[model samples]
Target chain A: MIQDIMTVAETAKLIEAGNVLLLAGDEAVLRQLPKGNWIGGTIPYFISHAEGGLATRDRIFVTDVTGVAQSVEIVERDANGLAKVYAEGPQEGFSVVIIPALSKAHLSFALNAPNYKDFGVRPLIGWISGVHLDDLGKVTPKVFNGVTGNALEEGAVVLQATLKPGKVAEVGIVNLFEQGGGDILTFPADGFSAKEVLVNGEKRNFAAYIVKNKLDTRLPLVADYYGALVNISFQGIDEVEGEVKFYAPVFTGIRYKHAKPVADYGEAFKACLENKCQLSEDRVVFSCNCILNYLYSGLEGKKTDPFVGPITFGEIAYQLLNQTLVYLEVHDV
Target chain B: MDVPSMSRPQWTDLVTGKKTYQLKFLAAKILLGRLVHSVKENPTPANIKSCIEQVYNVYAKNAGSPSVQEDLTTIFG
Candidate 1:
């Protein structure tokens, strides 16, 4: 039996091999509503009789509901008039998973993702996004790339894109409840032992799929974990003077799931604020700093909140909104 | 370390900076582990294998401790 999850290197290989791909959707048009993707079809939509905080069984009545506005009409039609049932949105709305304003290369990559066309070359990276329910459900964080020709701070602009099929999912692709949302890219780790290692559930290969043909355009998105977080930070920059640093409440990735699902950024933010997140005290680590710094070197402004050696109150509050930082450990700066 | 030969520049890179890619990578891995372990009850065999592979590949390449080294080999080797 298989026990441990694949390491990043191994995960990289699997991703390369195309055994799995980040789940994704075909293209569809939008109608200007804040939309949410729904599971393909298993879960049925019903009217939420009461209003307030969302209950387990409540359905956001399409328009007035608190969830992302995913019209069941979010789908594609065959020449025969049969709808594909994947979550789709009107032209004006957007999704964090497949946003175009950030990176066209990212979106294009997503379009042909897992394009197992060339089986003999390198396995293609596949993406699967079943993230239908937004954690905040209402307020979707806008994806901001650094505005060009402006200082990093000045051009910290939230962006929007011209989207296509890959940008939208058919209304009823998969059941979010049965699917249990959140993107995961599984990799190798030392979480397994000799005896019962093969069945280590936690070690399974779960990864986020952010590579939706993501680079065809000039968007600044990247294919790493800190996805939008890093993009926002590196929004505007033009070299360096002092130093760039971001101090925020960072949670241990070890217990991040316990806090909140990535699909729901608000509750995760809530969990971090409630002190439910923790700082990781152990384990070997790696920083995709190369990836991050690469972005910073190209940005127009310094997005660092304050490098006063420790996190500032404002920084903490900002992190509270993004929920990216979990622990408040201040590095000796 | 299990691997082999390193120059002086390697040592400087490892300890000279407060936020070297090396340190951050380790920090990220640890963070990922802590976060994942806390919730992975029976992280699937595939998940376990993936985790083990990540741990060992990094260890083999980076060369950390004896216990972790031993554990990694048992799973991947």
Candidate 2:
């Protein structure tokens, strides 16, 4: 797996050599690459081999999938067309997707992907493309269909790759936060922003509740989807409007609790990865950790060894996830 | 923990929240999650049957796993 940052010329050389690549970099640098078998999204931040967490616009982070993929196909889909994503994917392989942040496709996928046809039936992993923090309002995040060299700001760019026979792809997530011993919270509806919540079956103003309890907004609300511990990170609390915004949607019937506080984010990640993931580094072909984790955990100079890729705005294991590390492993049957 | 053997009625009961059991596979979890939501909204026999058929088809596709195949037989038989 060639997961490393390279100069524009180096990346173009790989693309020109027929490498099937997943790329992340600045829009300008990604635009400079030669059209080939690749899919890219704009993000200047990455966790590179040489640097623990680096932000650079001049280089591109590349994951060469040519070694494991027998054949690769790239497709672009808008919000309404994303329902066929899983059904259209290869039966024996996995799909990697990149949707620009704040795009209609991103919001649609985040809220409705679980209801999509054949959801979670196959391995699907990817991240949400984003601009640098400084460029949040000034620029839009974009995805590239490398074959056409078209940069799209509205839809998703998907790379569906069929694995070689005997090689199977599996998706897994590592989340450091778990349900804390607090009031069980449920929302009035499914949405990214909530003005009302049920606290222990009692109605309460969502933002007011957080403010009254002096809750730490950095810690997300955690829900157990079956056995998987999923997170909904807090984006912000609107005091005057009495609304609480989240990075991911909170469903109506789901039970969620504030995450247990972590004394040390870096050590917590290291220990969680050590205990939960005994992954052989080589088997992990692709992976991405959330940018919130990178920022909150102070990972700028720290290494989360054995896992490296773009530090993204959001993550996808099968559905949109927040504050989680999603990885795809190729195993021999 | 042993895999709980469930009959079709028991499966419906579980989906309708009459009983609860920890699902052992991702396929079961994903299918049951949607079914549970569906039956909660409308507990009609046709709706429940449609959910069951969907589950059977998805489980059949993943019958490559011995455990899934075993569960399928245990539930449908």
Q: What TM-score goes with each of the models? A: 0.19, 0.91
lDDT of 2 by residue, A167-244 (tens): 877777888999999999989899999999999999999999999999999999998765578899999999999999
> In candidate 1, residue B38 scores what lDDT?
32
- Residue A255 of candidate 1: its Cα lDDT? 19
Provide fnat values for all models in the order shown. 0.04, 0.12
Whole-model Cα lDDT of every candidate shown, in order? 0.21, 0.85
Error of 2 at B31 (Å): 5.1
Identify the runs in model 1 with alpha carbons over 4 angstroms from their true place: A1-101, A104-333, B3-31, B34-39, B43-47, B62-77
Question: What DockQ, on C-alphas, does every prediction get?
Answer: 0.04, 0.29
Where does the lowest 10-residue lDDT sum fall in candidate 1 chain A? A170-179
Give the per-residue lDDT of model 1 (tens digit) for A1-333: 111112234323432332211111111101111123221110111111132111121111121111222222222222121111112212422221112111232223222221212110110011111112332233221211211111111101211122222221110000011111233223232221111111123542121112221211112221122111221121221122221122111222211111111343233334543463233321101000111221212211222111001111111111111111211121111
Identify the leading candidate in terms of TM-score: 2
